[model samples]
Target chain A: MARAQWPLQHGRPIIEIVLTLAQGAQKVTRRLLADTGAGAMHDPFDIVLDEVDCLMCGGKPSKMVPLGGSYSGTHPIYVIPIGIPSLGFRDSLFAVGVAAPPAGFDGIACFRFLNRFTYGNFGNANEFALET
Target chain B: MATATSIQQLNRDLADKLVEEAKLDLPSWPLGKFVGIANGHVIVVSDDLDEIVSQLERAEPDPSRTFVVEPGRDYTKVCEIWRIS
Candidate 1:
């Protein structure tokens, strides 16, 4: 069976986890469009976990914290901070607020997500493959 | 009219434009902020943090406009993009 788990060592620190890929998940990310200071921005991406993927019941939600800012506005936002692992890439442990489901169970992948895998695109096939 | 767009709108427009640019060369996400236009140079911010920052520092940017990126967002919680010559 294909493995859904991976282990990594970051600067002498080792961590591991098992991940499940589902379809129709959405990825929320922040990109610098204008002169925004470094560290000035709060959580750039927030990913919401799907019910199927979310085995936790009572209050085990993708806990979101308020990142004070005028740009963030009055909107109340939350995020589920977790570690993500991919094949052939480094491990990513960032808080991804569960927004919506992804198109595929492959789960929502982001730039940080990119860091967790060996990524490349083939000609017209228009598909991405990853392994861990 | 204010002639200014909302952050959401700006992000959408930027995403579309950058995605198109990526077709030629995979454009980096969030080409920083478009602070103000001046001296014909479009000042860009450096969004990379930690190690990425170091990597970007060692590399050269497009020669035309010298993009200046403050380490992190300013006290305003926004980065300043100053146009260059």
Candidate 2:
């Protein structure tokens, strides 16, 4: 089981997270998931992946590239230029985008692969239940 | 030139603008983000305003990450765009 430690603030969850990548892991927080969800935010797919690595297989990914001039800030986001074998691997490569991130890692799950999973928000914790 | 009072005031103003204009369910806090405000409202990406606001509220000073949202500033549309690059 995987867990994340969050802060406890007046018995409310105060973090923003998203769960696009489906992984089976226990969530832990010092406070509560509610604190993370006081407003809209990205899912914590990386944190969840710490425990449950997505075991998906056999999919054709489109070739996408990032525009050199297109940038959000000074930070540089990287993505795979060519499609690679997704199956027989721990985590599959999906589409990448340059957008605002939530808390944990700045990687956003692509909607193409994300369509294969279900999501839930238990207070401040956001979960993605992927199709195995 | 910003005192605690000024921070408090800015926080309140941002909270009000976020609620009234953006139509987002934001919690009241002293944290701040680089919000892009055009006409009294914070500019934000269509699907990420909530995530940005929540992060602003919780993220603390960490040496691992460089970019950090300060407290009492507005982060409307002018935010870091994340995509598969």
Candidate 3:
């Protein structure tokens, strides 16, 4: 079993994880936020990515639709290989991507990814742990 | 099959490199805009999501190897927990 832990900041759980999108010999990586709340399946999307990131990562815009929340109008969707790494744990999965994510996050790690781990926070220590 | 362990290590390497590069590049990026990185380069920076996406498609065709980021903000800054009755 692999496990990793991150410290909480200002009463919030923040994890430093890398996201990778690879094609052949080309690969791009970005640090992203792993949100326990943001992990809900948005009907058709497995994960939500910033629109600009989606395209740069080679995700093709499929369609635009209302996603509500901080987003308005239709948003672009893309199919891509999304990789996540944290502490000593890492994995990549094929998922649908949405261009519109709330400001301040490169991307959101939702249930599609979070379900793979047993996670919890230790407020006394100001840390959170994710284990597989 | 790509095991979780292998993927995790690969992603860690990629993320470390990305963070390292961003330290040098992010200082010059325009604030309050989205930035996209592909092939280890800053490819796009814009406030318009559509425009950025369009540019990325033409520039980087492989979505898997691309990275996108927002500068100068903490990941937890805007997170909100809501309660519904």
Candidate 4:
């Protein structure tokens, strides 16, 4: 199994993601925050993307879904394929389109996406990684 | 009159207004496309956010009141996590 790792940004995990869109694949070299707490169980949104990023990346919402947490509302849900080359991970995942940013990150990688493999620093406090 | 449209300071009320305007003739709009609204009217509709912004700026007189977004029941609130630390 391949392993992919990245440095902690001010104590937060900033992971590199490649968004494969109809236009082409765009590498978000280091933009998405790896937040296991992003979405709850049963939530299909594996990532949270602001409208601008969603549109620029050519992500079109396949359906409109409701979200409840710090705020409660129904939002557009998009399907997009994301890849982490280092870990040899690639999958088609669902994402939510929002007007506001998810925390301060360009995007948020949630539980469904991160839980697919074993993830943690693995004793290396300076960095975090995923093992497939 | 001010020219140039922009999608900033977007509040729920404004978002609702845009959605309402778009819903007036949803039959003509394509699926998965974002709609730009300004001055309580639909400005442009496209899948590209940059194109929406560019067109809004060129067509609308007040860009500050412009907003481009998907006309769906989707919304997210931006607020700080309660910090007692």
Candidate 5:
């Protein structure tokens, strides 16, 4: 089984996953937040990103949809390869790029990604683990 | 299965190179903008999404293959709060 650990900060399980956005040979990697609850089937995307990250990754805007709260607006979606180096995981999924993301996160890793692994939060150890 | 494996392998290789290059080059890129990468090189950087798409259409027609980077944001902070109902 492959396992990875992450720290719990501010009552949130924060883990570093490498995100690779690519078309052909072009690719970029950045660390992102592993958010277990960020997934919403109603949203039309598997992951969420800051607007800049989505566009930089060459994601085309699909139409503005209401996301509720102050976050409502036009959001862009991109189909790209996302990788979690820690788990040796990689897959292509739809992602939403929003104008504003909450503090300290480049993007959120929702259930679409998290559902792939068996995870455990070891608060005592100040870490979380993911097993495939 | 074989095809999937090959694709996975290709993605891994591309990801490895990207991670390495990002560490070396992205530190100097201006923050709060979308940056596009293709052929292992930075192609365009802009704050306007339309501008990025236009440039990418000419540089990398297949957007899925082009990599985009969002520069300068802390990944450690708690961004979304979750509550199970």
Candidate 6:
């Protein structure tokens, strides 16, 4: 199984993923909140990014997303590549650009993103992983 | 871009205004076209995001507080847009 696992660094199951934003540039890693209850079919966003990060990464919107919950407006969506080194997984997915990201995360990995893999501790409650 | 520093320190009121302002003007443009706004003013309105950004680069030197969006797409509901603040 292709799996990427990490301990709950902030007492939460956050994942360390790298974004391939600029070619031949420094590796950009972002810690995202693994929110299993944070997405719906209406929401095409698989992940989230703050405006600065999004723009710095040259994130451009292919779609307009209306996010409910703490965010309430139409935001930009980008198809950015993500890498989970632990799993040796690299692929691109939809990311939403928002203004006020939560307090403790660079971004969020919503259910839509997680649904792509089999994720959980797989037995170790102190850690998390994406089993593919 | 680090969670160690929250974007809450930014001008949230201005950010909200930009998005709201863009939404209000969405109908005036063609569907599927992209719109870019920055510093509380509409900067680039074009057919795609690339064109918008290209025009935006010259229009707004500092686009850290900009908003870009497209029309005629599905509405996504974020059950939780936040982690634990």
Give candidate 1's error at residue A6 in angstroms: 17
Pairs with steric clashes in candidate 6: A43-B76
> Model 6, B1-85: lDDT tens per residue?
4231132223234434544565667666444455566554566766654566666557654445444554433244344554254
lDDT of 1 by residue, A15-101 (tens): 222432223333322211111121222333322234334332111111123323212222211122233343332221233223333
lDDT of 2 at B2: 52
Docking class of 3: incorrect
Per-residue alpha-carbon lDDT of candidate 4 for residues A51-70, written as tens digits (9 for 90 to 100): 66665555533345566663
| Model 1 stretches astray by more than 4 angstroms | A1-48, A51-92, A103-106, A115-118, A124-126, A130-132, B1-85
How many residue pairs collide in each prediction?
A: 41, 50, 11, 7, 8, 1
Best by TM-score: 6
TM-score of 2: 0.21
**Which regions of candidate 3 are displaced past 4 Å?**
A9-11, A21-29, A39-42, A60-65, A86-103, A122-125, B1-85
lDDT score for candidate 3 against the true structure: 0.50
Give a tens-digit lDDT track for model 3, residues A49-128: 66666655556433233444444445544545444454454332333344544455456555546666777763446776
Q: Give the TM-score of candidate 5.
A: 0.53
After superposition, candidate 5 runs with Cα above 4 Å error: A21-31, A41-43, A60-64, A122-125, B1-85
Better of 2 and 6 by TM-score: 6
What TM-score would you give candidate 3 relative to the actual structure? 0.47
Poorly placed runs, candidate 6 (over 4 Å): B1-73, B76-85
Quote the positional error of residue B51 for candidate 5 in Å.
27
Query: In candidate 4 chain A, what residue range of length 10 has the lowest lDDT sum?
Result: A21-30
DockQ of the two-chain complex in candidate 2? 0.02
Q: Which ten residues in a row have the lowest lDDT in candidate 1 chain A?
A: A30-39
**Local lDDT at A76 for model 4:** 66
Q: Mind giving the per-residue lDDT tens digits that candidate 4 earns over B1-85? A: 4333323333225656655765687765444466666654666777765566557657753434554456642333332211211
DockQ of 4: 0.04
Best by DockQ: 6
CAPRI-style grade of the A/B interface in model 2: incorrect
Question: With candidate 5 superimposed using the best TM-score fit, by how many Å does residue A80's alpha carbon deviate from the native?
Answer: 1.9
* Candidate 6 per-residue lDDT over residues A10-110, each given as its tens digit: 78887788975543556788998888867764355778888677666655434466766667877877645567887887765568888867787888888
lDDT of 1: 0.28
